[model samples]
Target: MTQNEPAATTGDQETVALTRPPTALSGDLSPRSSGTVFESAEPPAAASGGEPPEDPPSAPKAAKPPRKRRGLLIGALAVVVVVALGATAVFTIEPVGRVFGIGPSAVPTEPAPDPIDPDFALIPVDHVSAGPTEAGLASALQPSVTAAEVGTLHAVIVDPGTGQSLWGNEADVPATPASTTKILTSAAALLTFPADHTFTTTVVAGPTPGSVILVGGGDPSLTAVPEGTDTLYASNPARISDLAAQVRENAGDIAITEVLVDASRYTGQAIADGWDASDAPSSYGGFIEPLMLDGGRSDPLNDLSQRVGDPALEAGNALAAELGATSVSAVDEAGSPADGEVLGEISSLPLVDLIEAMMLLSDNVAAEMLAREVAIERGAEPSFAGGAASIIEVLGENGFDISQLELSDASGLSNQNLITPNLLGDVLSLAAHPADESDTAVSQQLRPMLTGLAVAGASGKLTDRYPAGASAGRGWVRAKTGSLTAVNGLAGVVTDRDGKLMAFALLSSGTNATVARPALDEVTSALRECGCR
Candidate 1:
């Protein structure tokens, strides 16, 4: 089908990897919020009023052991094994050889002619048994949640195996979700659009000769980088060079003088309401335009590079430069005629890859664009308000409760976004849920969302996190990180010591991100270390 045609519905797609190689966005974003408009209520005090008296306190139990990094523990075990082998060779083996007179009598040994082949495999989880008991999970997590640094919190942990709640604190209360909002945005995109779907950007003949129009198909991954070079959008992105080549080949002997950009596929303000004004041209986010090079970044290779003021116009200029025009200028914003001849066109990487990039980089522009795609597919107006409404509607159709949800933008850059912790946890649970008869079609489509999350201490925004007290979760935890001055959040999945997969969401407010984020990490680390039964 053509790029403008209504796309097919969401269906089973190949599972995507949650982690990816390091990129420019890392270390550039500060873990500070611009402001906190929502003040989350503190955890409630213990049972009050008519509650009965409890029994006397019992004796204190032994202190829990300190957490250990996975890599360090494995190294320590390897050292012990090597020392044991050395001792056996020197003492036990030598003594046995001497007593049996085997040292002199034993036949000489030689290495095998063929080399040993390595074996690699994925061991499936033993899901017949349930994960940690609810009481045990509460015991293991309560202390960490109550720490002062965590501030007012809403959190939940679930065993995805049975979709059971293992622990919770004000989980139903709605609060600012920060970037964890991407979870819902991702889930909706997977449910509404086919996995291999793509957006196209095309160059067509303008109304007059020596003029051409650049029409956007709502693809922000269109890039200005030289062909064959990598940009912040890792998947081989659509290149302006290739688009120009096509236009030049088709428009023979025509000296292109004017270039126009048509970002008509998307409607509404380039910036969302409630978004911080300073963020538009900053590293973390940019104006949400449909046609832009490298997601509107001034430096396509640098994730932290400042964004351009008018991304659509700038894209038109790039095409002008490529066409050898004297100057890049958008002669008309009205758009090309319906009968304009197609000069050239290019398509973005598959939608699945775009979702992966959005999650891995916590990319705001990509998220907004994807959300608009969702809106378009569902027949909602392709705008900030329409995208937000369409996402909530899609999730609701897939069995999630949307009563408490509120959104101003799909990227969660807006401080106005509000989502319950339970809702976030549920979305994650479905994403991580096992494939079986009981699994919903929504679960199958959302599985790719897991692969896009940042791995703790390994990739993306979580590359340097889970330190010290949270070391045990370094490789075991995979989550999406969120931060806005006093707001912080972590939502994703982790496998515990017992090999049981669990999904969790933690949103905090009334505290600085610097302290709350580390505290949140400690909580997930506790989950990784617990074999709570």
Candidate 2:
């Protein structure tokens, strides 16, 4: 499932105090048009008939809704679009959310984002009994392995409750993981980067007087979202207008003659190797640049919107518009500032939020950006080769076997990438229950990964799944989905009938998603229903 095609085209609570470069591509990416485009749940400027809201409310509000992010909100919307008996019914999720006053949208003014805290209260495994006997579990799952199971399926189920490998079938064999590779990218990111990490976009005095440079700090959340208006993608963005205001203050009357975009932080080709040329500017696939607005979306609000070919330039234009500069002249590698004085800077959301967005939307560009951020953190070159090498290095440092895996790109957009189901399940196990329970440090750090996996028939990639036979897993199974022409996979955690937490990874090849998706869903469904005591 090269995410470049279906991925954007696609969290948890752990309260670890997090703060750093802050950021949004948004909570969840809505999949629409051509199968590759996506949009976060940002507020549209206008309403019905492009009209404004009936009236502005001048009242304060009360009530705290569930902690909402783009993934959660979009996942909830997916539930409504699907599974609802009344398909033609017209309704709005906002009013329903407002009645309860759960999210930021409910507030008249957006409240400052709360610090990173995953409040990890996953059904405690202390007293939970082991899952069904291996034999019984095998019997339960055997029905799901139709003739389709021949030799293409590689799967693993881990019962974290008992800390045992519950099942495996060719699980250790590495194969093309498709988008399931994001699990590795995200895990490595969380393990190494701070809980609250952020990418920064800065405005520094350029090499010459009267020249202003907008340096790309690998911040994609920087957006064209109008002032005071918020979108999921721009929950907390580095605004060009803010930069403009700061520059105006610093340079008394000296007019800014030019706005230069500094994209020197990243090196290598804009598009990654093994990627389709069309994927670079596709709604789902965007060039890997340090600076992009709304994830390289031209419309800034629609995921299906055309992607700008030169995001660095588009970003420069956005800043130029803010500076009141009629047009941007050119883009060049920015030289060191003459003085150390910084004109202005804006930070992205912490690393936690970015990781959540990546998992929720399966954002290929976001995944690449995060991996590059990791590369920067590790002092590796910030490119696909560097990111791929760094992720492998980080995973090896953390004790995962590096010998079994081969990675081409961070977002799992490459058909050449190979990973085993065993590693996938192992990663999920680490996210659910770490090496040290007494310290619980790993659990605290990796908990967000669990929170971000798609819920069965409920959210994210699983939204349209589980409509009927797999209903047992609805809201019960939480995992990631991977699909390519002849590949399909699912990986994530789920609480079973015994209330036991389990991690599972199923990677299948030689079959289309239509045939393999339901078969894999049935496997998770079997887990949810199996109460073998």
Candidate 3:
């Protein structure tokens, strides 16, 4: 039969295709030798009764054809194709094993990651450490003064590098900071406003020929002193005299018959809501108005004056009178002058310098004026309320926490204002230096302002306070002095033995300022000498 034909075997009653067999199959046909006999003829009838079966002799089993090598070769080719297909699927598919029936363990999986602790992730541990200990620098400041006096004293020294409480009683308590409050105000102002900002005072032509209206820009430093009256502007007063003369000169003998003063740039609101009504108006406690120039006029006769009676309008009028002007009025009702001509104009010292003066001398009128001016610039009402809101807004933008702070006015003239030492300390530290390495304007401005402060046993209100060698500190303490009826405070930078600068604030409340001043000075002196260890 052909290779494609099926064959029937007697021993096994199954059809089999015998085209090719394994190479091991033998070619010899010795069927009789084993147990069965294979013949070329049909088998004999069983008992003579069966007729002889006739069938063509099955074709001699073709030599179990030489074992086909092609079968093995086809199987090997099929295996190679399957392996290649599996590899292609694995390379092309994202998650390969799921698409085909292959070794599952061969697939790779990303291992689970460790979870993070939220609390530990948020804390900033760069500069701070654990709580203060008795054996540390804080313990060195332990009070030697008795408890009876301790309750009346708010004294403490601190290492600015570490927030360690060095020494004192009632250090944690809040107290009226007095002029010390200016530190906070100055820092906030400097941080919030640009250093080169200049305040404008315009001179517009009035209705009358040769007459000009001096528009107030809340410039407290406007001066008219001829050449040399004094080195400082505070001592030597200069008004708008030269400016008006120049205006007259430009106008060619155009007599300034009527000079109208415009003081409407700022809102009329002066004193803050929380200020006490009974405080002396001359004591720097009077509410600050935007229009009243020169710390609300130091003269007593000027009813328009808010603090000392000397009104900036009066000063302007005096300058005009000296320059041969007919009249001067401090009325805010003047309309915009006619466009006759533009006259001379003067600008106030840069905002940075003004702020430094305010901070160093603790000038209440200047501080209040600046606060209101800031409000006006921001397009808000130039009232104390508006100023407080603006200050808080600026502080918040700089990442400060204003929850515990209360600001009724820019100057600490009002007993209603309250701030914590910690908060003040934090602000001072950040603003102590300028942000740009090349610009030392802030530092230079701060130097002049600081010189205005009352030095111990030298100048200002502290002319004769601390004696030499109070506790190991002498001639080394330079700080701002604060005093109120029930509050006294001293806060500033002190250099230790190793030349390390340390910033500290000591505030005392519910005590006599006169009695507490010495204690505060003593603590400051002690810190200066590194007596607190």
Regions of candidate 1 where Cα sits further than 4 Å from its true position: 1-121, 331-333, 468-470
Q: lDDT per prediction?
A: 0.66, 0.61, 0.46
Residue 382 of model 3, lDDT score: 78
Relative to the unseen true structure, what is the C-alpha lDDT of residue 182 in candidate 1, on a scale of 0 to 100?
Answer: 94
RMSD of each: 17.1, 13.2, 45.2
What's model 1's overall lDDT? 0.66
- Worst ten in a row by lDDT for model 2: 1-10
lDDT: which candidate is best? 1
**Native-referenced Cα lDDT, model 2:** 0.61
Model 2 TM-score, 2 decimals: 0.76
Tens digit per residue, CA lDDT, model 3, 154-214: 4455444443444435655556666676776665566556655657666667776756777
Candidate 1 worst ten-residue window by lDDT: 73-82
> What is the RMSD of candidate 1?
17.1
Q: Is candidate 2 or candidate 3 better by lDDT?
A: 2
Quick one: ranking by lDDT, best first? 1, 2, 3
Which residue runs of candidate 2 sit more than 4 Å off their true CA positions?
Answer: 1-126, 147-151, 329-331, 334-340, 434-440, 468-470
Collision pairs in model 3: 223-238, 224-238, 224-239, 225-238, 297-310, 297-311, 298-310, 299-309, 299-310
What does the lDDT read for residue 146 in candidate 3? 33
